[model samples]
Target: MISSLRKDADIIIKKSIDAVLPDEAVKRALKGFKKGTGKVVLVAAGKAAWQMANAAVKEMPDISEGIVVTKYDHVKGNIPGITCCEAGHPVPDENSFSATRKALDLVRPLGEDDTVLFLLSGGGSALFESPLIPGEELQDITKQLLACGADIVEINTIRKRLSGVKGGRFAEVAAPAKVYSIVLSDILGDPLDMIASGPAVPDTSTCQQAQEIAARYNLKLSDEARNLLGKETPKELSNVTSVITGSVRELCTAASNAAKDLGYEPIILTDMLSCEAKDAGSFLASIAISNSRKGDKKLAFIAGGETVVHLKGTGKGGRNQELALSAAIGLNGLSNAAVFSVGSDGTDGPTDAAGGYADGETVSDLKEKGLNINLYLDNNDAYNALKAVDGLIITGPTGTNVNDVSVLLIS
Candidate 1:
């Protein structure tokens, strides 16, 4: 039963991944959009940039040119006619600044008869960036915001303030050129203004809101960052149009289908799940435990959304990994349960692994090796802890990002 449960867990997770492939989602969204006869240019960013650009070019063979800025290694060989650039993610590095500058160059000179297809997805806030302040200052503030566990919306509110292209500034700069955005949402509720920091759309976030977010995290910003917080982003852009191509809901539906195929009664707890990493993990484990107590075999509870991690220790793990590790303790001796957490983008945090997974005996197995799970959880070291237990799930770059999915199973 344990082996079958593990197999079923793998199937469910794979189904979730297959549902959000950037290429397929882009093609679906393109079908509903009216592609004008203008000189079409493609500007794709985030983890799925390459896949989306390739798909768009295929759909519109008349595209004049294309530029793709994606995380390093996300680009598979290359596509003819498209300039592919690999950049930083979660944190913008020197290459990120360089690549985004070129992307901006491609669109800034467009005529009203020209159209810029902005294939925006999660991680664009870092993968495509042109800093308003010094790059070093932006980097420092980014680190602060990340470690402080401010949610994505709060982080982006401040990020839009510091960026030259974010928060609809890209559309503002490309004025006269019609901008059409195909967005694969990585944020909850599909807030069009927050996905990829809303590069081509109007930003509703104000400088005042950004300042408040900084204060909430007690982040120390440079004077330039502080001054820029009061400035408004491009709150209105007449040249931009947007369409949401994918989201966490799709992930949830696919997982549910997979669960049914495996004879499990799947319940989608929430796609809007937002909380601290550890809390989510423990809470999911508790649900699994409750089901197990009721003799509810073949049951799965799933959630999808991004969670924040307040870094209290120097650790190497993302929220997904931390979540699975935290669940390890709660699921310690329940021989019939398993909990897995994975980032749909196929990469979590700075690690190459997508996320982590654990079974009921995880904690006991760790103890037999003389390791304390609590110590690792406390240190935010889920990567190493899960590594020791062979719990890490490494899928490489999935060519997509639609936030995260955590599955709790009891069978």
Candidate 2:
């Protein structure tokens, strides 16, 4: 049964990614571009940065130059034409700083006769951090936000304010270069301005908004960040063509199809699912329980959205693991029901495990092993909690990212 669940999850995730590869999306979006107008320069940053760059290269073989920054493990074998740099994720390291600087340098020399292809995806915010605020201050504030369990949207709202190149500044810097952005959106609803803090899109969020978000989460930003947010972005650089090529919709569609194939009635609960991890888990569990009571022979509920975990303990896991574990605990003894949550990128939070799965019997299995789910969750240790019951779903790297997908199956 566990093996079958894994297989179904893998199929759903892979089909979702294939539905929105950057190459296919870019080709469709570039249909209006006039031939031989100017040189094409590709700049990308994220877990799928290399794949996006490769897609661009395949589409435009004669492109002049390219630069991409990706997470350490996401960078596969090199492409001879494009320069690839591996950097840190969830937090920006010195390498990310250097890579950002390099990307900036590559774009600074662009001309009106050139077209800049910006490939943006998940993890780009940390993978290409240029601190308009002091480096130390930015680092401190980022740490606080992560520890506070701030959702991606809130974290990115603050990030855009502190960075010199985020919030459409990258497009501003490459002014006159005709920016064309292809994005694999990880944010719920695929907000163009929120994905990777909108490097190539205008930012409507204000300094006050950033401060409010920080205050709401009890995070204190440095004086530098506060001051930078006070200034207005210049108006001369607003030329951007942004296209969202991927999102949670793909995941829901794939999961729905997978369910149908498995002889189950698939219902997409929501594509804009967002909330605290525990609440989301419990809500899904209730649905599963209700469905079981209806005497449904087979049914699947699909949802796609990112959830947040307030870090209370030093647990090693991502949001997906936490969600799965919470659902397991909520469903304690329900029969023939299972929940699986996974990040489409094949990663979740800071852990090596992609996500986790939990069934009606998951809680009992953990209890049998003398594992305390509450204690582990309190310590933010969903990774170990799920692993104890063989619930961890490990997928090294999917080379693509949309967002988080949750599947609840009742049989």
The most accurate candidate by TM-score is: 1
Residues 216-242, candidate 2: write the lDDT tens digits.
887775566777657665334557877
Counted clashes in each candidate structure: 0, 3
Cα lDDT for residue 382, candidate 1? 91
- lDDT measured at residue 148 in model 2 versus the true structure, 0 to 100: 89
In model 2, which residue pairs have backbone atoms overlapping below 3 Å? Answer: 313-379, 315-380, 315-381
TM-scores for all predictions:
0.98, 0.94
- Deviation in Å, model 2, residue 353 alpha carbon: 1.5
Compared with the true structure, what per-residue lDDT tens digits does model 1 show for residues 295-369? 745788989998889898887999999999998878978888998989998998999889999888889888888
CA deviation > 4 Å runs, candidate 1: 35-37
